[model samples]
Target: MSETNSQQNINTAVTLLERYAEGKRNFSEANLGNADLQGVDLKGSDFSYADLNEANLNGANLRGCDLSFANLSQANLQDADLRGALLFSADLRQADLKGAKLEKADCDRSTHFPQDFDPAQVGLQIKDG
Candidate 1:
């Protein structure tokens, strides 16, 4: 990434953290690449179109969040609760979803998964038009 983009990401991450600390959870269109947001309780937040590549979100509560079109590539989502989350068209390539709860979470053909990763095996459902 370019230096300006990196600075933007850092700014976004700081803003997100500050908002979360201030009891704000609606973080739509956030740029949080490579951010360390592990174990945060962000349930029902809007993260659509966010850049979360390589972010450490292990054990985060993401249930019912809107993550559509987000870039979650290489993110650590181990043990995260993502039940009913909207992940349609999200990029999950190379992401670690071990033990994650994705029951009723929505995805579509446009959603990208890691190589050989089975969405069905992890309870991720395809969204109907």
Candidate 2:
């Protein structure tokens, strides 16, 4: 998708999130590529199938969030909390996960980990790839 269209989708998503009253906000299938989402309280939100490639999520609170099938290639997730989050079939190729917490995050073989990360150091149990 073009950059302009992607930016518009991101703007719409942000507006929806801000106007959300109760219940978990569903941002599934939204194109949010290259958007800045730093320090947002997105806990328990549904981001399934969202295009978040190259987006910045530094220090974001994403605990218990559903990120299944999301395209997060090259995204910045530094210091983000992903405890108990679902990342099934998510694309994380080349994404920066420095100092991020991934405790109990459910990932499949298709999920890519950072090259610089040592599984033991981050307490991640690598399943079949």
Give the winner by TM-score: 1
| lDDT of residue 33 for candidate 2 | 85
- Tens-digit lDDT track for model 1 on 1-129? 553343244335566767677776666667788988788888888888888999999999999999999999999999999999999999999899988899989999999998998999888899766
lDDT accuracy of residue 39 in candidate 2? 86
| Clash pairs for candidate 1 | none
Instruction: Show the lowest summed lDDT stretch of 10 residues, model 1.
Output: 3-12
Count clashing residue pairs per candidate.
Answer: 0, 0
> How well does candidate 1 match the true structure in TM-score terms?
0.85
Error (Å) of candidate 2 at residue 41 is 0.4
Give the Cα error of residue 36 in candidate 2, in Å.
Answer: 0.9
Model 2 lDDT on a 0 to 1 scale: 0.77
Candidate 2 lDDT for residue 120: 47
Q: Relative to the unseen true structure, what is the C-alpha lDDT of residue 64 in candidate 2, on a scale of 0 to 100?
A: 84
lDDT of each residue in 1-129, candidate 2, tens digit only = 564443235344365356344453676777878878898878887788888899899998889888889998999999999888888888888889988898887787767666766644665545565
